[model samples]
Target chain A: MMAVAADVPGAFERLVEAYEPRVKAAVARSINDRSSVEDLSQEIFLRLYRARQRYRPTARFETFLYRVIFNACVNFTQYMARRRALSLDRALDDDERGNALEPADPGMARPLENIEEQERAVMVRAAIDTLPEAQRRALLLSRYEGLGYEAIGQIMGLSLQAVKSLLWRARDNVRKALIPKLGEGPDA
Target chain B: MPDHERIGDGPVLSEAQEQQLLAYLDDRLSPDERSGVDAWLARDADLRRLLDEHRRTWELLGELPVPDEASPGAGFRENTVQRAHREERLRQRGARRRAMGVLAAAALVMALVLVLRDRPEPWARLTPEERHIVQNLELLENFDLLQQFETELDLAADVEALQAFEGELTETLR
Candidate 1:
């Protein structure tokens, strides 16, 4: 990150190569509009490039990166929401909006199992989406990316306790939402 | 009693206790904290159940497919680098343009100062009346010397007196 910051044009490709997976995953999980993931990812990299000079090594690089990703996702979500609100011909569902959840494995031998898994994935995603923005982000960062509470706090600009609270609420909410469909089985 | 101590009627744990459980689950707690939570979990059936539920819910998040297309795709690196370079060039160009603007403004100010510094004073570019006053400046200063003659007629009336007065005046002037 420091190298990229020093000479963004020259050293940025290395940074991109290193962090692209995490960046894409962050964007993918944050927004429901999967179609825009590529575009949003590109935009995020551009923003990172533009903001290279402001990077300070005092903070963790992933912390800084996640912060940028969080802000971008938020802005993109808000923009999409407003666009949807303004458009007379808006889609009724995410599927119609061209963000249908793809099956985990399209060519799997067990089509039934794949479809069920895809449905569960969609349900879980929808549950996640129902959470407030902060809770959702906190959940994603903590659960998916496996970031610690302090890092999550830094990324979200929350206190450690606040992050803990968000994560708890996020998990509780998802649990409540899923329990009816999934049942209180040992695995569930 | 704090709300977290009770079980089975409403929310089993207070928010703080729930947060602690979450921290424990995430392995964020210190060993002592973890031990305390573990002891509580071992003793309390409700707390254990809640922990299990939270754990399962967290695990359920794994079902959300790790985007197989995690890569930003082919040419992403090259594209991003090219775009960054393009933006950098544009920014540098903008900076250069701004510098040129500032230099142009400074040059204009300097030119104005030079023009003003070597400029003739307002009085030096005299009007006709001012020119006349300047031409007769010495005469104006010595008007009392002319008092010897009442008029030109008197000077003509006593030509010898005028000639003597002129010689005296020349001697005084010398």
Candidate 2:
């Protein structure tokens, strides 16, 4: 870890090589813009590189990396919101709004199965998107990334209790949103 | 009672109880708290149902598609590295410029100190005798000639002879 911090450029390449997929996925999950995922992921890496000198070894590197990702996502979301408010091009259609989630792989299932799975995926993505930003972040970090509550709190800058509250609210909100479409049962 | 809190005519779980159920589902509760929740779940069908709903919702999150691994493109790693290199160069250039600026400023200060250190004192600081010599600077400059004359002649005899010559010149003129 110290080596990664010390030799930022070299080690950062390795880090990017290793963690690019995770970073891309995290950014894609956090923001609604599918097109900006790569750009945002790049920006996150650049931020980490710039801050290498100040990278204290106090916390796990992954936690620190996620913190940077979380901050960038938050800033980007706010910027997009402001842009959306001011721009006359706000009349985004449903397809454009739900562009972040790709359809499930066709080879993985039959055609009908793939379409149904894709629809469910879109619904789930939309439900996750509908959550408040903090709750969404908490939920993604917990459920998707499998981070502990303390780590999620550190990444989101929330207290432990606040993390719990956000997760609970996030889960409850997603449940309410999904139940109407997917219904109350095991995975279909 | 809200419809969400209702489960087949069973009693509702309070907000705290629901939070506890969530913690239990996540396995975040302490052993004792887990035991407490276990006892509650064993007795309360509504609580158990709520837990199941939360768990299923969490499970449904799996449906949110993982971003395609190829989405970042092949050049992403190289592009990011090149960009970082560019930034590091800019940062180093800035540091060098700042260091040169500091060195230039220090050199200017040193030059000023040397000039001031060897500088003459103010006129007001001169003694009265020194001021007098300064006022008679032309005479002092001619002192070498005056010294030659003083060494060549007897001053008192020259004065008496000049007086005698003056008396004779005055009588002739009269």
Candidate 3:
């Protein structure tokens, strides 16, 4: 990180080039939109740059960076929430969070095919947006950034064992809703 | 999907098996362990399927595109460093100003106490004239306080300056 910061004129560009893709994928998988992923991800990296001189390589770069990205996305989710009145809280049914997969459409092929991968990506995003904050952050950090369990633990302030177990359950729960008819029960 | 990992031989993965599999997946296993896991995997179809599924999930998840790069912005580092520097300087300046203000107030109070100080009154109880002079000296010390603050402050000298008062008082005392 210090190396990246000291990069001088091209340092910020180098940071953007290196970590932008990972942060992009993390935010994309997290939110129900593609257009803002790049913009939000850049903000995270920009924040990193200013704080980089003080950066010690205590945690893996990916873990630290994703934590920032995760926060930025959550903030964005809240800010944009005012318009649609749609929110993670609103998405929850009265009973519990992971009750059943509520499909936004009744179509057979799923709307993703008709609207293009980008649009389908948005629906897939909506599914991700519904996860609890901790689970979502762990899942995204593990899946998109390729962080090891210990690294995820460090980022989320969880133990390694807890990270693995949490990720396992998070992935299982998300899969249940995202691929409702694709697999069997949660265990499957 | 977890059912895929249930091999016929073991109920749970041994440390060796766990290490072998994890290392093979990460491509960091020793050659012997590599071949061992490969051989173990070849015998167990369920294990193979689990590995395949894990890989597939990994690939599928990896396919989700990453964030976009907006330029980090103009003067981001410079602006942040400058702002912090200015704030810290202002804080130090404020602290120094407060210290000076406190010192000035304390000095003013001490000066006021000195100027208004009262001395022991001369009484009918037998008192030496020297004791009275000493009491008057104590009163004189209070007048000196004003001089400490302003070099040009002149005291209003009164009848104490008159030769007759000193002469008469000297004769009475004698």
- For each candidate, how many residue pairs have backbone atoms clashing (under 3 Å)? 0, 0, 7
True contacts kept of 2: 0.62
TM-score, one value per model: 0.78, 0.75, 0.48
- The worst-scoring run of ten residues by lDDT in candidate 2 chain B lies at B1-10
Better of 1 and 2 by DockQ: 1
The numbered model that scores best in DockQ is: 1
DockQ for all models, in order? 0.45, 0.34, 0.10
DockQ of 2: 0.34
Q: Write the per-residue lDDT of candidate 2 for residues B1-174, one digit (tens) a residue.
A: 232356543445566776777778878789999998788678766666667776778778976677763255789999998999899899999999999999999999999999988888877789999999999999999999988888667777788899999999999999
lDDT, each prediction: 0.80, 0.80, 0.61
| Candidate 1 lDDT over residue span A11-103, tens digit each | 788888888888898888888766787788888989988888887887888888888999999999899878866553433455587765444
Alpha-carbon deviation at A138 in model 3, angstroms: 1.9
> What is the total number of backbone clashes in candidate 3?
7
Local accuracy of candidate 3 as per-residue lDDT tens digits, B43-162 = 776677556544544444554434342334355445444454455478679999999999999999999888757534345443688667677886677777766645543322444466
Q: Which stretches of candidate 3 lie over 4 Å from their true place?
A: A1-116, A123-127, A130-132, A171-188, B1-40, B68-174
